[model samples]
Target: MSVLNGISVSVGPVLFKAACPDCRSRFELAAGALRLAIGGSRRTTFYSFTCPECGSAVRKPAGERIVELLTGGGVRTLRLHSTV
Candidate 1:
């Protein structure tokens, strides 16, 4: 395992396996790339992404899918879809 910057490397067959924090359901993900959607009335920031497997309603109202990316000096995360 290679370490990029201070965070672990995220490449090759990246698998994001986690239980839905809301539903407590296990999820296995295999996405080609991380997705992001910018939104907000006053402040702009990184929001949650979406789930390809489960429908939009599963994580709606706000973002759901977020992936960890390693950069030159640090790590940046991008959301796949936003519920809101």
Candidate 2:
């Protein structure tokens, strides 16, 4: 079990509903299948998932709300630092 935002969630193999825009195929994916990145700029911050049906990579913008949900859902997240 895991606690997210103070809410207890079952930590076992949980499936999340995902859709492939390219092939229009809908499927379920585990938390490990998704990746989230928090970047310094809006354009750099996004979430990624692979489409099992078409093998296409999908990336979507991760706004504040999306970030919260993704993190709470146990998706592995990475912090991006700008080296300048």
Candidate 3:
């Protein structure tokens, strides 16, 4: 876990499915270690994925903004920040 800015980031393994925008291909993405970049240094955590047909990533990481990572999609940065 990493604290970035004022947010507590949690990095953990995740298994998800991704749909290709171009090919409309549906695949699975599994992460060994979820990465969370925090602070000014942007320290990151690591994760891994294993899938026979999944050879590529569904989406990229989030930018300097706070975003929600969807199952198949990438991170979604919202206009407002909230913690549940």
Candidate 4:
């Protein structure tokens, strides 16, 4: 169980589907296995994980919806700060 914005949320084992372009292998990864990075712009926002099959470090672009889902699913997130 978790709380967000004063709302109680159920915490479960969350798994996300991911594919490795290098090996063309597709698999599911747990929330702890993934990392989300929110950047200053859409182009910079993305998620990353290691390919279980090939052990390749993979990164994919994450949009608004992806960010919401990932954050809600309990994936660790890092906010990128940009100094202009």
Pick by lDDT: which candidate is best? 4
Candidate ranking (TM-score, best to worst): 4, 2, 1, 3
The 10 consecutive residues of candidate 2 with the worst lDDT sum are 11-20
Native-to-model Cα distance after best TM-score fit, residue 78 in candidate 4, in Å: 0.3
Instruction: Assess candidate 2 and give its lDDT.
Output: 0.90
Q: Which TM-score value belongs to model 2?
A: 0.78
Off by over 4 Å in 4: 1-12
TM-score of every candidate relative to the true structure? 0.31, 0.78, 0.27, 0.84
RMSD of each: 8.1, 3.9, 13.3, 4.1
lDDT of 3 at 61: 42
- Please provide, for model 2 over 9-66, each residue's C-alpha lDDT reduced to its tens digit, 9 standing for 90 to 100: 8857757787888999999998899999999988999999999989999988889998
| Candidate 3: regions farther than 4 A off | 1-13, 32-84
Candidate 1 deviant stretches above 4 angstroms: 1-12, 37-43, 47-54, 57-84
Model 2 steric clash pairs: none
- In angstroms, the error of model 1 at 5 is 20
Give the worst 10-residue stretch by lDDT in candidate 4: 10-19
**Residue 69: error of model 1 in Å?**
2.3
**Top candidate by TM-score:** 4
**TM-score of candidate 4 against the unseen true structure:** 0.84
Give the alpha carbon lDDT tens digit for every residue of 1-84 in model 3. 879999999976555654555466666654322233232222331122322454544333443432234322342222322343
lDDT, candidate 4, 1-84, per-residue tens: 999999999977888988999999989999999999999999999999999999999999999999999999999999999887
lDDT, candidate 1, at 76: 34
